[model samples]
Target chain A: MKRNVVSLTIAVLFLTLAVTGVMGFFLPFNILTVSVHALLGFVFIGSIALHLKNNFRQLKNYFTSKTALLVILCVAALVAVILLQPKPVLAILGLSKNLGPAADRFELKDTKMIYNYTPAPHYKMQLNFKGGRAFDAEKPPRVAIWLENTSRYHLKTLYHSKAPDAQQMLPYWHYKKSEYEKYKAESEAAEKAGKKQSEDVDALSSATPNESFDPADYIVPKDPEKETPYRLLIEINAPDDGNEHYPDQPSLVYVVEVDNKHPRSYQVLDLVGYPKSEMDEEEGEIEWSLLYADGTITTAHDLFDSALLLIERSDPIK
Target chain B: MKRHFFVISLLMLISVWVFFAIKAGEEKTSYQSFQGNIFGTRYQVQYHAHEQLDMDAAEIQAQVEKLLQRIDKIASTWKANSEISRYNRAVAKDEFQLSDELREIITLSEQLKTSTGGAFDIHHQGEEIDVSAIAKGYAVDRIAEYLHDELAIQNFLVEIGGEVKARGHNAKAEPWKVAIYIPPSHSHIVGPRVTLSNTSIATSGLYFRENHIKNAETGHAPDHDLLSCSVIHPSNTTADALATALYVMGAEAGLAWADQNEVEAIFIKSDGSIIKSVQAQR
Candidate 1:
């Protein structure tokens, strides 16, 4: 009974190996075939162990025989022939030329080979600010400044104040408001047509689309927002600052910046600024000036003076 | 006789176990990748085989380098001593003897030239043949073939510069994923990912370091209005030639041509709009 069981197991394992091995050539590499081939391999090993135990003496005599030695020598000779005659074998395989100069005849010179690669550099201007008292000498309001690029894209903001929880400032105008209107129009159209909205429109509806919003939400940010000491969190205002104000509401709001020395009922800055294109060879600098809400004109320097900073170069702070 | 039968069976079983053992060891260290310079750019080869392979990685690399070096010798216009250069330097009317490999490339180029309406021509002024556009693709195909046929490596990815030929599953037993970069993108945000299985892909664009691709008729590079053109085909050589031809033919014409020819392509416009070919959409 034990002999029958061992013979049956060996037969099954052999069949599995044969079937999977043949199928491997005809069929594309698949997980099922590969898994079965691998699993059967382990079973084959165990079955072969049992087979060897039942016929150890015979198996040892077979390896010691002249036929086994001759087979091993033949296999070794074949491998040696293949290794030594690579070019000829490759030529027969249609992978090499039999007559022409061999592939390694000519060596590539070091002059022709490029090893190093340098990426294009990005240019940025830094600004430094000194002590500038707020509009009120007693209760100085936090000063907020917005920086926009040549394309009117809001680059960043620098909020200078004693109150870390100061209310966020607003722009006289925002480019995102236009984008929101555009998205709203498309969403409405898609809804009217009874079609599923695109992922962009869906995400735009679900989340507030601000300067910080990235179109590709599937990607995780490499540097996630952490409470690092030196890291400054800049809050980009929404297109429409939904009816929220602060006398002292502690809630951030878009407020029109004003100069000092004016009373509590001072004029708001309502300015129109056109960003200069960086591509223009003659006029590369962005020129923007502030205007009072009461139609009073102000110089560009006074509004941007505090934000103008010098690029600092220092050794590591040990 | 019974003892002889047991001996033969045991011998066969041991051979099978040894085969499986070697294959398992390879699987544990599967998907061997090797990279080097080829065709004036970088070439990378990655392959995995469950079966026992006769040639190790060093042998495979040696073979692959030989094939690519031969291609450079036959097709490279930069090499003065190359066969193509020799043919170019010969009298216009002289019958130039061509190698089997060069002859094959010329034949393929002739077909592409006819189909692309002379846009993909290899010959310049009807004498100097410049097969650089298609040669890289051919090299990629040759390496992929070496892995598939000579080495019997089915699961493999071969990339020469931006041209790629991929087959079967990756190390994770999933289709190989390739990223298509958006043309003229400011940031290095991840582009759209396409799964490649037994297919070839090649991208042609003005954004590359070299401005070699040009309109054959005009003898000038095409306008940069169309950022890039990427073609996918079963044949890597065809995909490479099509990509270059389509880039020469602006975005609209390229899309139309790709549609008519029933070839898969992706056109990235300067304005950041991506247009997919009929096959790609399907």
Candidate 2:
């Protein structure tokens, strides 16, 4: 029973060594595998000692014979040859998949990481109104804002009340998307019919607001109970300059404001709106809302729209 | 049996000690490098040293980022709220106040513009001012200085984008070798292989962006006969700016300018021919 137990333990440890030796090729060279292999190797050596002890009498007789001497000599020679030419030996044995330890073989020869990489700077700005005595918490304010470049080129809008009217006023985005779909269908139909595609002039043109009354020009809302009071936040990411920081300056100034009560200028600006098609497909795309200083309000469908609207309404800091 | 076991254990201990000793000795001559992204471009730093670097990886990265952010505040036009952007947007553009760094860049730009005969104009009247051409090179030099002076790194190669600054011997104790590739056209050809030591190389290629190198005279992209131009100098700033300036000057005039100035330049022509400046012939 003692001999059997010793043999079994030795067999299990030798099997572990063989399995792990094979696994060393497929698995990445990490501490876990290396330590396990080394520890198991030490245990396998100890197990061999135990095996020798169990069969000391028979082992002594066997080792003294000519066959044992020849076997030992052959093993030593093979080990020496393998040490000198590991690759060829591995190739012959069909174990040349991972020729060496990964760390030594796959080390970077050219460049080193001196610093951890980071992307370009992204910025955010917010407008918070510590509500004055006359301020209404229920009614959100009307807001419209856009950004311009250094040359006064109209880059984008930071906030727009019209785009954000879906929750409180109307689903203008749905209407806008429907109009785009309608136009696209017509255009495709025209192509199929081999006719020149017609442009939607009416859809492209801005709808004329009531000449008698201007929504943006209206500083005060009629019913305080019906409005949702909120604060405005704007975020913008530095656009890719073909993987470079071009010396081009971003002009961050919002010029148009409705209420004189809270007047402040901001410089961080630029946002792109997700197209209506994408907005419909993706849920939780529109997260934030923009509240104007006046009693008007708008919903920001995404960070891009909010950034655009925020920049559009912001007065340039002098 | 007890004596043999003791002997085997002693041999194993000796073998382990020898292995560790050899490993410790090898660590002295090993090559190490650091890489990161800054100023919208990738930067790689490789150094061969007898000892470990003065700064760890995290410390080095943090310092580089901090330096880049400082430079961005001064020179980046992408940050609308940055000092440079504010300066650009100022109504009082004429005689506007300048930071020390901005003032230095403007002065250098003016000098280069004069030297290159308007071939290196960064600021144009009634147009947006841009210093991207030279700022990257300057940043490269700054990093090299930080590595060499602060970190006590002597043998190092620093590369930002296609701009490279190399000093001392490489890991194999050889001059740093750099290859200039021609802007890929119909035929994929190589420009020149240059050996650099305590020198910088900056290449300007037209294949990446059309009209990126605008002619100050015409206020449009130059219709140059050259596909790419590379300049090597001790100063990264000069190497970077001159490469762009030479590209703008075109093949004939650009080559003539390089020859006259005795500047090392390699111009890859649109016809897939390579031309070397007088100094580059060495």
TM-score of chain B of each: 0.87, 0.88
- Lowest lDDT 10-mer window, candidate 1 chain B? B182-191
Note the DockQ of each predicted structure: 0.02, 0.01
Per lDDT, the best of the predicted structures is 1
Q: Considering the two chains of model 1, state its CAPRI-style docking category.
A: incorrect
lDDT of 2 at B176: 78
Backbone clashes in candidate 1 total 5
Worst 10 residues of 2 chain B by lDDT: B182-191
lDDT by residue (tens digit), candidate 2, A107-184: 111221011111101112233222222223233323333322222222233343432432232222233334434434
Candidate 2, residue A118: the lDDT equals 10
Q: What is the lDDT of residue B213 in candidate 1?
A: 73
Candidate 2: Cα lDDT at B272: 76
